[model samples]
Target: MATVQFKGIVKKFGDNLVLNGVDVDIKDHEFVVIVGPSGCGKTTLLRMLAGLEEITDGEILIDNLLVNELHPSKREIAMVFQDYALYPHMTVEENMNFALRLRKMDKAEIASRVAEASNVLQLNKFLKRMPKQLSGGQRQRVAIGRAIVRKPKVFLFDEPLSNLDAKLREEMRVEIAKLYQRLNATIIYVTHDQVEAMTLAGRIVIMNHGIVQQVGSPIEVYRKPCNLFVAGFIGSPTMNFMTGKLALEGEALFFKNEDIKLSIPPYLLSDAKKHDGREVVLGVRPDDVLVERDGEKCSDKVQGVLEVCELLGHRENLYLKVGGMRVLATVEAFFNRSPGSAVTLCFNYKNMHVFDKATESRISE
Candidate 1:
């Protein structure tokens, strides 16, 4: 286990800058995930740390030792790639012990390490199986087992489960999380899936356009997103945004748009005042938007025509058209509503978010 540090890390492919002065730190034995959209330079960042990609500027330190110029083999790190780059000619056990054999380790020691990794990955019964004979999940576990045999100081996984089916991906996520606890190893994983990032990481590093966005625990980032990009990226169903201008009316502050007017919550009063008369974006998650039922009264209400209803077993997703703006709401499945049905929605302002429209940055609480 080792601590990893990226101090002002930058990467470039010719004239195109892939990573723009990114900085982040991972404590020893911490499971940190770097996540973002495609072409965000997350994979490039991981490759730089693994010594596969060059850092155009800044430094990377592992275990307090600068490894900027170190070879990939000498960095004491193992990478499991997206494609599970396994040798078709090798058996599971042979694959796990390949690195050890390359290092000219004793046969007995190599066998011992292979057995331990096999047991940890539950690949004991599949030791003689070839990569082609194994399922997608099993193949991925074998890839992880190969990394574990070296006992690297840090493990880097680049979307290791992306090739698996949905159910298999979910199962592998649990397996990998358990592996983290069992080995207590420092791991840096890169993924574009927020579900994976939120569920597996002790701390998450959000990146966009080659820049680090936010770094925090799952709950911290979800509850307190630093900007519009994070607020939109971190949650399922995505957060809804409405563009409006802040206006002061008597002693109250309101966010007014063409079709909706919402009063700013008390906690945001001071911050809202700073952006008075300026355009702001109000953010509300689908879970916080309630569909009003018969005999129910809500202070903040808006009307929309339901466009689509998707029943997702436990919950439903309602797509609505509110004054030319599209809104998606996730609600309990029991509250059935047909498409084209006009409905009123009530927003829970306690969990609402406000961002400066011009800068796309969150307004402080």
Candidate 2:
């Protein structure tokens, strides 16, 4: 296991800056994930660390050694790419031992490494089978086994599960997590999937347009996003946003839009006071929008016409039109309602988020 560090790393294609002054320190034996949408430079950062791409400015260190100029083989890292990248003519055993052969490792030692990795990956039964004969998930396991045999100081996974089906991806996620625990290896994974990052990473580095938006645990990023981008990007079904302005009424602050009004919770008074009368964006997660039961009384309630109801097992996503803005709520699967039906929802203001309109940053506690 090894620590990885990126010091003011920058990448540029001609005049197009891809990564800008990025700095991060990954601890030894830590499973850190860099995740974002495509073209966000997550892969570029990973490639730079792998020595596959050059750093236009700044340095990369592995285990306290500056490796900006080090060859890929000298970086003591193994990368598992999106494609399985297995040789067609080679069997699983051959594929696993190829790197060891290239390094002129002893035959017995190579066999020992292959046996152990095969056992760990449950690929022993398919050792004699060629890549062409293996299923996608099996082939992926073989690819992982190849990396495991190397016993590199750091493991770099670049969307390794992207090719697998949804079910296979979920299974592979658990398998990879177990692999990390078994080996206690320092791993840096890159993916565009936030779900993968949230589940696998000890710390997630959220990036967008070549800039890091936030870096923290999944719960930290989800519960307290630093800006509007993160709050909108990290959650499923996306968070709902309403444009409004703060208004003062006695000691209470109210958020007012055209025909919608929601009282700001007292806990956020200190933060809301600074932006009094200024336009702001009110954010609430789908789960936080409670579907009011019949005759239930709530102080912060809004009525909307149900537009769509997607019945997902255990939970349903209800799309509604509140005033002129669209809102989504995750409710019990049993809560059935047809389109055009009027529904009342309670806004859990205690869990609500308020963002400054000008800067698109969170202003509420």
Candidate 3:
């Protein structure tokens, strides 16, 4: 186990800058996930840490030791690549022990390490199997096994499950979680999938355009996003955003847009009068959009026409049109409402978010 640190990390490819002044501290035995969209430099950062990419300016410290100029083989870190970089001709056992063999380790010691990793990954039966003979999930497990045999201070996974089907990915996620518990090793995972970040990470590092957006537990990021991008990126089904302006009317602050108007709760923004006539964006999740049902009315409910209903087993998604704006609401299965039906919906203020339009930063508590 080891603590990893990136201090003022920067990378450049000739005239193009990929990462700029990125800083993150990963604690010993922590499962930290770096996640963002494509071309965000998440993988590039990981490669820098692994010595696969050069650092234009900055320091990488592993276990409190400066490793900026250290060779990748001396970093004491094993990386599981996105494509499951296994030797095509080598058997699983051969691939797992290749590093040890390169070091000219004792035969008995190499065999013991291989056996231990095989048992941990349940790959004993596939030890003699070649990479092409195994399934996608099995090959990924072998790649991980190769890393495990090294007993490195840190484990880096670069989207190791992206090549698998959804069902296999789910199963591998559980396997990796269990492996973490058994090893209690420092793990850094990189992926573009927010679901993977939210479910597997002890702490998530959200990055965009080479800048770190937020670092916190999944619940912390989900419940209280720092800005508009964090608010929109970390959740499922995406959050619905309504752009408008805030106007102080008699003591209450109201948000007015072309499609609808909503009163901002005092607790959400205490100094309401100070933000009078300010452009802002209101954010609400699909699950937080309350729809009128069972003859019950919602506070500040606005009328809309249901445009579509998508049934997703245990839940249903309602697409509604209010004026010219579109809104999505996730509700219990069998909403029993057909398209074109008139529906009234309101936001759950407890989970509402308000952002300053100019800075794209959250303004509400």
Candidate 4:
């Protein structure tokens, strides 16, 4: 397996700048997931690496060697697309071994390689099945098995599971993770699903508007987002942003917006202290809010009326209207809660996320 790097990569489609000076490095043998909303250039980046798209400007390095001009087949990489792209007339084993046969590899060598790949993807039982005869997950596995048979130095997955049903997508995600472990190959997977990015990636690269927003581990990026785009993009329920003004009340700092005035947790005050009286954005995740009478460690409390309540078995999501702002809070699944009741809630000081009102960048020490 080889490490991959993109330096100052840029792409444009007839004046629409798609990738803007993007730079990223994928460690050897690492499973890196690139996530962004549609048309954020995530797939464009992958296509550039695969030599499928011509990058307008930049360097692409595989194993520290410049490969911007390298042909797709010469780059020592295999790509699996969202579509299975299987041969309708060929059996699973034939599809898996087609590339080798084209390269004129010995028949015995091709058979051994195909058998090994089938075992890795658990497709041994489906070797005789044609594309139309197998299920979606099985066909996807066959796609992966074909890639593995080639022993490519790097693997690229372009939303390969998008074609599967939700349940099958989740199952295939685990299967893909296991395949990565068995092969130990560098992988670049592009997906819009945050759940897949969070679960499969060793590192998550979040992009927006053709620019890279942030790159960090799933937890790090989730807890400490680089900018407003990332804070809003990477999580399931999405972090809540309240427009507010940063103010100094005596020796302490607080952000007051609309009817809510929240103190900047002391530990985080260091960054906002100098900019007292300036405006800033307050961010908090739904999971960080606690129900009434929940704790004593909360920094502030709000009295809100639940406008909508959803029971999720493991937890309940309460959508409340605190003045003009709509706040979503998650409570224990067993907690008895209903709409129209007024409830007091608190949030931990350490859980608050603050951003610069002007630049929208996170105010982190």
Candidate 5:
């Protein structure tokens, strides 16, 4: 496994620019996932590294050697695509060994590689099965197996699990995670699925508007997002954001909207001191909000009427109208609250995030 590095990479289409001066270094044997909403240049970045799409300008390095002039095959990298791009006529063994055969490896050598890869992927029972005879997950494994047989220095996966059924997608996700460790190969994965990015990556590169937003471990990004796009994008149910004004109520630093007022935690107060009376975006995660009965008193509470309740088996999600905006919060499903009831909502100020209203960048130091 080798490290992949991109220095000052740039990509353009006609008059429009897709990637701008992007510089990232992927360490050896690291499973780095690049994720973003559709058309945010995640695929473009991966394709550039895979030599599928040429960069308009930049340098790409593999194992500390320049590879910008190298062909995809010469780069010694393998790619697995979303479609499971397997040959319909080739048996599973044939599919996995084809690349080696192209290199003029001996027939017995081919069988040895096919056997080992098949065992790793549990594909022996279906070795003779053609692409049509295998399930979607099996086909995906075959695609990966083909790459595995190459013993490539780097592995690239482009939404490889997107076509599988949900259950199958989950199962394949586990397989990919295990395979990464077993191979100990450097991998760069591209996906729009946050769950996949969060679970599979050693570090995640969150992209937006053709720019890299943040690169950090899943928990780091979840706990301390750098900007509004990342803060809102990384969490499920999304972070509840409301426009508010920062103020000082005596010594207390407060974020105040017409209906929602939350005091900034002491840890965050010093950093927010300069933004007093300025409009700020208040961000809080769904799980951090606690619903209380009408008469409860809490440090930072809001009064809102329940507008909708969704029972998601394990949890309850509520939509409430606070001032002109709606807030979504999750609680244990058995809370037994009916819609249209006036309820007091409590939020952990320490867990709150504050962002600049104009820049959409986090202001909570």
Candidate 6:
């Protein structure tokens, strides 16, 4: 296990900047997942750390040793690629021990490592099977086993679960989590899946447009996003955002848009006088949008027309139209409401997020 640090790292391909002035400190035995949409530089950052991509500027350190000039093979890292990258002709056992074989390690020691990795990955039954004979999840386990045999100082996983089907992905997720507990090695994983990042990471690094947007534990990012981008990206069903202007109504502050008007609780936004007439965006997650049902008394309910109700097992998604703007409220299932039905909804102020529209930064305390 080793600590890894990136100090002002940058990557450029000709004139296009792929990564820009990124910095992060990964502690020994920590699992950090870099997550972002495609073309957002998460994978490029991982490649730079693994010594696979050149750093146009800045330094990378492994256990406090500068490794920007080191070769990939000398970086003491193992990478599990998205495609599995198994040699087709080789059996599972052969593929797992290929790296040790390349280094001309003792045949007995190589066998020992292979045996231990296979046991950890539950690949004993498929040891003699070729890559083509194994299932997708099984092949992924083999890829991971190959990495385990290297016993690298740092492990890099680049979307290793992306190729698997949804069910396989979920199962493999549990396996990987178990692997981390057993090895406890420093890991840096890159993925576009927020679900993976949320579930696997000790901390998550979110990137967009070649810049690191925010870094935090899963719950921190989910509960308190730093800006508009993160607020909209980290949650399922996405957050519902309403564009409006803050208004001063005597002692109170209110948010008024063409579609809706609601009081802005002082506990959410302080210094109400300063925010008067400020253009802001109000954000609430689907789960936080409380749609009134069965005469439940909800404070500050605003009326809207139900446009659609999507039943998703135990939860239902209600797409509604409040004047010209749309608001989505996720509620308990069996809503049994038809389209065009009138509904009343309000936000759970405790979880509401207010962002300055001009800067796209969170303004609520």
lDDT of 1 by residue, 1-365 (tens): 89999999989899999999999999999999999999999999999999999889999999999999999999999999999999999999888899999999999999999999888888999999999999999999999999999999999999998899999999999999999989999999999999999999999999999999999999999998999999999999999998999898876788899988887766665754566798889888988778764323333778989998888999999988888888888988866667899999877766778899989999857
* TM-score against native, each model: 0.96, 0.96, 0.98, 0.97, 0.95, 0.97
Candidate 1 weakest lDDT stretch, 10 residues:
291-300
Clashing residue pairs in candidate 2 are: none
Runs off by more than 4 Å, candidate 3: 293-299
Collision pairs in model 6:
none
Q: Name the lDDT value of residue 262 in candidate 5.
A: 78
Q: What would the per-residue lDDT of candidate 4 be over residues 30-106, giving only the tens digit for each residue? A: 89999999999999999999999998999999999899999898999998988979999999999999989999999
What would the per-residue lDDT of candidate 5 be over residues 229-248, giving only the tens digit for each residue? 99988989899988989898
lDDT of 5 at 130: 96
The backbone clash count of each candidate, in order, is 0, 0, 0, 0, 0, 0
- Highest TM-score, which number? 3
C-alpha lDDT (0 to 100) for residue 191 of candidate 3: 96
Query: How far does residue 36 in candidate 6 sit from its true spot (Å)?
Result: 0.4
Model 6 misplaced regions, further than 4 Å: 293-299
Flag regions of model 4 displaced more than 4 Å.
none
Worst 10 residues of 2 by lDDT: 292-301
Indicate whether candidate 1 or candidate 4 has the larger TM-score. 4
If ranked by lDDT, best first, what sequence of candidates would result? 3, 6, 1, 2, 4, 5
lDDT at 152, model 5: 94
Residues 32-122 of candidate 3 have per-residue lDDT tens digits of 9999998889999999999999899999999999999999999999999999989998999999999999999999999999999999999
Score candidate 3 by TM-score against the native. Answer: 0.98
